[model samples]
Target: MKGVLVLENGSRFSGELIGCVRKGYGEVVFHTGMTGYQEILTDPSYAEQIVVMTYPLIGNYGINGDDFEAKRPWLTGFVTGETCDFPSHFRQEQTLDQYLSEQGIVGLTGVNTRSLVKMIREEGSLKGYILPANLLADGEKFDFPALPRDLVRRVSTKQTYQHSVQGESHVVLVDFGAKENIAGALTRLGCRVTVVPADTEFEQIARLQPDGIMLSNGPGDPADCADLLPLIKRLATAYPLFGICLGHQLLAMSFGATTEKMRFGHRGSNHPVQDLRSGKVWITSQNHSYSVRREGFPAELVVTHKHVNDDSIEGVAHSVLPAFSVQFHPEACPGPQDAEALFHRFLALMNERKGSQLVTTI
Candidate 1:
């Protein structure tokens, strides 16, 4: 069926509706990854947004069960230049259109995604809608509601769960719409992981007797998560901590640092980041619309890594506390694994803290 993507600025583009035939509305953003559509679709960090794939051809490999980053797709809509109808991958379970339809996700194809991306870049991100072609001809004004402030709550887990039971170190992961690969990466590092809801209290996490804590990636602005700052501050003091994406922004905020929305946020698999301490560079996967402001950062925090493209603050570490965070995904499921060493760094921090406490007792 014919479809039209209408931007809040009154711009419209015609396309083919490949998924559900329902109208969808949200903030429009673009991703540059050439692959990983399945992982991107299910990532909770895309919640309440309409994603535009800039790579042109999408879903050539088809959708497989193993590639899902979350239980379901959280984005309000999907946009692509073209989609593969007959996928030939050995692991393929279903076509992208079939998968999106089953999951109630609306998708648009045959649209000039490059032009859409350019518009978002030139004007900053905009609110947009995906509707049938008939709606455009009606010439009626559309008033889309503002994106929700509680997107994290809408995507976060409601209960605590355990994984990697036999691993040595006990780590409590505060699940703010976390991707499964984050837990998988922790388990691979020999950490026994316990995932708790985003609003899980400090007392509950403390009771877990964790060796370390992880603040997970999620949707929405970090300022919207002001309530979590106090809990994060307390946890940072009590345990070794690591954070990713939105978690990184929130952690910085807890230290009295500020965060601001980007003109066009980084959302791709191949961003280059340089480690300040070692002067080493690594390709990373990133997906966030806000970043921690480098100016007036807390004295206790030190910048560790920076984005090579825009010189944005990509990673930070506490000078005294065994806590650190990165604005990119080190547990990249559909991207390069160069940043995976960050997980090992977290484990080393936990070990160092344990040895220090043992020596203090002696």
Candidate 2:
């Protein structure tokens, strides 16, 4: 069936409907990753966004159950230049079309994705809709509601859960729609992970007596989560705290720093980030729409990593507090694994704090 993608700016592209036939709408954004469609589809960070894959061909690897980042796909819609109906990977359980259909997501195939990407790059992110070609010709107006501010709440866990129970260090993950691979990564490092809701109070967290705290990646504006700022501030003061993506933005805001929406935000796996301490650049996986603003940044926080492309803040560490954050995914499911060592750095921070407490008690 024919489908048409209409941007808020009045631009339109007609293509074949490859997934569900229903219309979908959201802020239209593009990702440059050549692979990991499954992970990107399931990542909650893409909530309320219609994702356009810049890669000319998608779904070549097929969908596998093991690679899902979240329990369900959260993007408002999917767009691709071309989609493979038949996949060739051995672990493939089903085609991407089938997966998106099952998840009630609309997808457009054979689209001029390169052109859409270029437009987004030049005009910034846009709110758009994907509907059947018939709807476009029917003269019926199509308008989507404004994206909600409660995106994090819509995606975050409602209850706390545990993972990697047998691991040594106990870490509480404030799950603002966390990817499962993050817990998997910590588990691999012998850390017991307890995931809590986005609005989990500091008192509840304190009762867990966790050795470390993790602020997880999620969807939407960091300012929308103002209710959690006090909790983050309290936790950062008392524990070894680490954050990623949205969590990084929240952490910065907790310290009186501010965050701003990016112009066509970074959403690729091949971004280069320079580690300020080591003076080395590492390829990173990133997916976020907002970033920490440099003006009036907190004095206690020190820049640790920066994006090589725009010199944006990619990582920061508190001068005296055992807290740090990064805007990129170190757990890289479908990207280069070079940044995995950062998890080890987190582990080292936890261990050092533990040793100091042990000495103080003795």
lDDT tens readout by residue for model 2, 1-362: 99999988889998999778898989999999989899999999999999999999999999998999899989989999999998999999999999999999999999998888999999999999998999878997866567888799999999988877878899999999899899999998899999999988899999998999999999998989988898999999999999999889989899999998899899998899999999999999999999999999999999899999999999999999989999999988445677888788889989999999999999
Worst 10 residues of 2 by lDDT: 333-342
lDDT of 1 by residue, 1-362 (tens): 99989999988878999888899899999999998889899999999899999998898999888978899999989999999999889999999999989999899999998888899999999999998898777986899777889788889999998967868788999999999999999998889999999999999888888999999999998898999899998999999999999889888889899999999899998899999989998988889999999789899999999999899999998989888999999999445576888898899989888899889999
Model 1: lDDT of residue 142: 92
In the predicted model 1, the residue pairs found to clash are: none
Model 2 TM-score, 2 decimals: 0.98
Candidate whose TM-score is highest: 2
Query: Which residue pairs collide, candidate 2?
Result: none
C-alpha root-mean-square deviation, each candidate: 1.2, 1.0
Model 1 segments beyond 4 Å from truth? Answer: 333-336, 360-362
Name the top lDDT candidate.
Answer: 2
